[model samples]
Target: MRHLSPGELIDAAEGHAAARATAHTEACEACRRQVASLREALAALRDVPDDEPSPLAWDLLAARIGRAVREAGAPKPWWAAWGWRFAPLLMVAVLAATAGVGVTLWHQRAASGSAASAGAVPGADEALAQDADGDERAAEDPSWSLVSDLSAGISLDDAADVGGLPPLGGSERALWQLSSDERRTLASILEAELAESAAAAPIIPGV
Candidate 1:
């Protein structure tokens, strides 16, 4: 049978696998190794403590807050504040700013989509490839393309000729030159393979 995957091993390590899987893992040496690795990782995670704030830290924070309260001058009435009177104006200004930003973004998006549909804009992939090429040239480091003219100067006709090569060219080239003894050995090997396959799956008939 095939070995258990990492996720299956993790579940086994955690003692969360089904009965059948657990049985198989118990017998399988490969799965035992996988489970051991996963358990080691789990152990490492378990060793890291969940950090909590100390009481001394809380006390220091409370002391700072109490000192700030004591130092503040005379308290004023909440309703008499200028901020309360201008609250509506502040809200109107914020809303206007948000609406202006939304409208600008929407118009820009519409323009971009129209340009894309008209095929006026270069594709994302094309732009990325161009940018990469530009960066490579600017860096002045010889790229795979520059170091090997293996592909650089190849014309379309040359490419087509290469692509259209006979798939069995090597076999065809060697087939015609084989000696009689070499042909006999190849035939014997084929016969042996066929015999083994047939013997392994012999037909059984019943009355």
Candidate 2:
């Protein structure tokens, strides 16, 4: 059997060694005696009291602790202020709300203008029906004759004639013939009427 080293004997004496070392030390007189002598010397050293610190040491320690506490309690820098931290977020929110309101107003104005224009147009429903009929006819016959007839101008005998060019009555007939304002007005009226019809149509369910 090998004898335990001084380090192992000291660890066993301090209750930190394995059980086998403890049992071997208990059964071995020489190892047990050496361990007891080391323990007694340590016990004697532990009985000595530590020396007291000088008066200046206590003052220095108190001042250091006070400075540490004061630094910890001081106010933060301007960059860490609450206003600076939240300003960007507030700006983004305000801009988003403004954009949303602007978009809503634009759409509302467009809708109102469309409604007013529709109210001004005469025979809008008839025009729409005629247009639909014309589209169907054109689709069925690629070589349509409607464009050629319009280009040739209408005759007084024709059903679609405007009664001999408004009877050549003063400047009003000339003004009516030369002015494109009527076409613009008619277009505005048609746009309004279409917008109204679209609004009145039944909504389809689901997205």
lDDT of 1 by residue, 94-125 (tens): 44445433443454445547768998863333
The clash count for each model shown is 0, 2
* Candidate 1 local distance difference test against the native: 0.54
For every model shown, what is its TM-score relative to the native structure? Answer: 0.28, 0.28
Candidate 1, TM-score vs. the true structure?
Answer: 0.28
Tens digit of per-residue lDDT, candidate 2, span 131-151 = 333334333432223223332
Q: What is the lDDT, from 0 to 100, of the residue 61 in candidate 1?
A: 93
Report per-prediction Cα RMSD to one decimal.
33.8, 32.0
